[model samples]
Target: MMVQIENKIILVTGGAGFIGSNLCEYLLSQRNKVICLDNFATGKTSNIQHLLSNPNFTLIVGDIRNLSDCHKAVSGVDYILHEAALGSVPRSINDPITSNDVNVSGFLNMLVAARDAKVKKFIYAASSSTYGDSEALPKVENTIGKPLSPYAITKYVNELYADIFFHTYGLNTIGLRYFNVFGRKQDPNGAYAAVIPKFVMQLMKYESPIINGDGNYSRDFTYIDNVIQMNVLAMLTENPEAMNTVYNTAFGDRTTLNNLMEYLKKHMSQYDEKIASVEVIHGPNRAGDIPHSLASIEKAKKLLNYNPEFSMKDGLKEAVDWYWNNLK
Candidate 1:
């Protein structure tokens, strides 16, 4: 059964993280009742601190790895947005077991709880890394290469399990394959920090930023707003064609790392002129890194009517302005 957005009870796991927190705020603005589940591993309370006062929002500090917590979080929820997982390839490469525990086992636990609770729909955060080693430009939904890292494997497993639940148990599941999502409230100090926020932070401090692999490697860097839109559409979409399918949630454009640095510097320079002169250091390609990634948003558009509002340049400007004001 399709669930309406207004007044629906929604559970967003990892709702205190970058994308999750943004989703929480969006859902609440729509007047939906939202429950946020997090163990605070990578998520911070500060992300959702502004929304804490809203009566429509509730926070549960619990690990998804625990079945009881999953059950507890899913209770009385009409929709489930599973976003809690250990992210980053390097983090997984260093500790595959913990990644497995959180991304794989924890995902299964959430699936069981959501299914048993008879939730109307289950939407999850899939990754573009699942297109690992495929050498294909503008990756499509059906075609994918073998996963390159523990993190990639975990995200791939999410799609696989979601498919299984749909076939076997009649769970309505949709996976949104996110590509390099970035925006405000994104942690800039973490060791596995994403490119945009990290670069913005370094430039704000007038520090040199590192460009991996000569900055030629490009990515389909998505904005947090686009991801939030996809989640809402996934949960609210009533089109039979959209249900139980994976859609690439991206802008369908590519930006090279070198070009991205130039753009970032241009934007940051508006606040501090010295930032425009900051040199970017080059480094070797990191392991489990893709040479390039671009998503074909045709599926999302045809199925979910997804129309991304921000391009790379526009999204970066907003992100840079946010980091400049908040971090500095």
Candidate 2:
């Protein structure tokens, strides 16, 4: 049995972020009352600005690191889609303490508040980085390697804490181990920007986009709509076995950086022919970077009936159109 996800109150943490904002928008469209809690550290106000006038939307400008904020956000919430955290492995490496504070400690704060509020479920954005140093091809839920970076460590810790919360406190939690997610509203301007949007923007300007490695590194590259679908499925699923477990939220396929560049250039050329001429530069491999990352999404499929609607190629085309129309 699946719980209907309409006309309920949902709290989306980091609601102004790329993934969070999209979740907020989707839940609102479903007639669910939405409370957006964000510190705007990495999240942008513009992302949720359009929803500000909606009667069902409420914005709480707060940090997850603050327990009071978490408590306040959960006061009347039915479910929580926790997307608040400092992303990017390099940023975490540069400031491990701050990352730990936000990703780990702040996560604890939200869990405590959710447990106290007795929300239906606590669904959070876990990461592919948790696979870490393992040379695994298709990462399964139970098997994992030692974390390779500070960011990886924090995300893995979140899974551990979520499991503990379920067992100890009777708090139902679902952790979605997201692969390389990308799509609309994904910011292209940032030192830590995701590769797809960043590359699209760079190519749009006829500037050469740099690949961090030999251009052979690959990722599952799940789309935002697919991610949103997984989140909704996580919320609606009444399967007892599905609750209190982690699932890989991905499209279950991988694309190399070189192939990704070709896809982007091919799509962008429709708007401007010059985009195709833009060269892609290959540089040395990035630190704490995995060579190839893929997901075995069988768990999510069998348990939640999660069917991803977008392939990497299909999503890239959609995302490129969005960036071209909005950013250009």
Candidate 3:
């Protein structure tokens, strides 16, 4: 059975973004009070529009980059799921300064606030990109490689800060290194949009989806539902060993980009057969991108009892259905 985190005031930073908004909605459904702090720079208002009506859901228009804003959001909160960060490797590559400001500086600000607020636990979103330049397959929690981009460096810095907060200030923290997460409400219109959502949007319109390389890059494409489950587990787990460590939040499988496109087309073809005929275009590989990513969920499974219920194919089908109905 899934552990329940109920009746507590939970803060979700970047709560207007894709994953953060979903976490807010779920927490509210479980009878918990949810405080969402967002600046809406990249987060869309449309994402959390429905939840605005709920009294249990409080929206704070704030930026994490500001220390005062972090303090305000952390006030009277029992726990925090810090999802606010500047994602996208290319964006960080183009402008490293802004990324560092929001990701590294903002993360430190949150850690300080969480410590001061005496929050029970601090669970923040880490990234698989921290495994940059590592040729190892089935990435383990302890092993990592040198960061390849500013974004990766920032995310790695988050884990470091979380660890120090735990040791120096006696804060309980967990960092979830999320792989290629996708599903409903993931914005498909952005220069830095994730591959799955971007491709799904294009295929729905019968537009040719461009592959960055020869289309063999594989990823452990995790479903949003699975990610949600992991977050909740990270929050509620009573195991002391589980505390003050990071876990790879993934579906424990890999799918090549070519296979991913084929899966998307197969799922979408159910609505429009012509989607199968849409040709895929190839382009140069993206900078700061690794060729393959897979995760070893054994650590998470044993420590947190994380049993991901969706394979890449299953998640892809669900995502296709959502985009077809909503984005179309």
Candidate 4:
């Protein structure tokens, strides 16, 4: 796929991680000079080792928490795609201080660097967790509830800081509030892994995936390609209204855990028929987990002209294919 923007130097902060690595590859393929800054905390080296040989791609082994590292990474960069942060809600619950330091303090450092360096745009990875305690079915960008966890608090803080940076220092910014994103290169081994990859891996290994809360809870499961489209749109959008605001990056549909499991099992069964027989166990609901999440992508569609290409099932099949060829 052709990346929308090219020839300009772009900085991706978590470029060794799932989403960021993909972004780096896409940008490089589009003939952009891409700089990847990663500390590799949760990001894996293997994810980006393929790009080290690309002449247009430069790798910076650094952390966003450090202002100097941010400054270093931002030098000569035309745009910033800030994807670095501690992502999981449960991980934040267990270690709020660390999550705050990386997601909050680190974000501030990057903004300062971008402002100081005068980057053309500062786009970032926000979270659907920002919807928080709100009972709204389809979450809009403006309306939000009190954050339910420290991770959510940190993400909300990122939006607040970005808004202030735009208002105060005139740093042009766009925040993409990502829903439950899943696809190729996503981590499925860790304890804080997202549901789809974790479940996919389990089913592949013939292990039962534990469903937290009877598999009724649902999410606005988004694909990585959709997310990449959002970042590209955010970066290249000429609309004045699109700047300094947030957009929900999602496929704009909801899928229950039961349905998600059924889809995963069905797809994985094509590769290994035994996978369909893998039982799904029910467990108590996880703390800090919302019952349901759905996003109104109308904001993105209206502002950024976002047209997500993959639905849940389409993305699942692609992801299953990737895991089979790569991991299984």
Q: What's every prediction's RMSD, in angstroms?
A: 2.2, 1.6, 0.9, 0.9
Native-to-model Cα distance after best TM-score fit, residue 243 in candidate 3, in Å:
0.5
Error of 4 at 39 (Å): 0.6
Q: At residue 5, what lDDT does model 1 achieve?
A: 60
lDDT of each: 0.92, 0.93, 0.93, 0.93
Candidate 3 TM-score versus the reference: 0.99
Q: Which residue pairs of candidate 2 clash?
A: none
lDDT of 1 by residue, 1-328 (tens): 1122688899999999988998898888878999999999999999999999999999999999999999999999999999999999999999999999999999999999988999999999999999999998889999999999999999999999999999999999999999999998899988999888888888888889999888899999898888887888898888888999899999999999999999988877878899999988998999999999999999999988888988988888888888877878
List, residue by residue over 1-328, the lDDT tens digit for candidate 4. 4237879899999999999999998888889999999999999999999899989989999999889999999999989999999999999999999999999999999999999999999999999999999999899988999999999999999999999999999999999999999999998898899999899899988999999998889999998899998999899987898899999999999999999999998888988999988988999999999999999999899888889999988999999899888987
Whole-model lDDT for model 1 versus the true structure? 0.92
Better of 1 and 2 by lDDT: 2
Per-residue lDDT, model 4, residue 263, is 92
Flag regions of model 1 displaced more than 4 Å: 1-4
Worst 10 residues of 4 by lDDT: 1-10
Q: What is the alpha-carbon lDDT for the whole of candidate 2? A: 0.93
Query: Candidate 2 residues 1-328, lDDT tens each?
Result: 2224799999999999999999989888888999999999999999999999999999999999999999999997889999999999999989999999999999999999999999999999999999998887899998899898999999999999999999999999999999999999999998899999999888988899999988999999999999999999999988899999999999999999999998888888989998888988888999999899999999999999988889999998889989988999
| Model 4 clashes, total count | 0
- Candidate 3 per-residue C-alpha lDDT over 1-328 given as tens digits, one digit per residue, 9 for 90 to 100: 4457799999999999999998998999899999999999999999999999999999999999899999999999989999998899999999999999999999999999999999999999999999988899899988899999999999999999999999999999999999999988899997899989999889878899999899999999999989999999999898999999999999999999999999888888889999999999999999999999999999999999999988888878888888878988
Against the hidden true structure, what lDDT does model 4 obtain? 0.93
Looking at model 1, residue 211 earns an lDDT score of 90
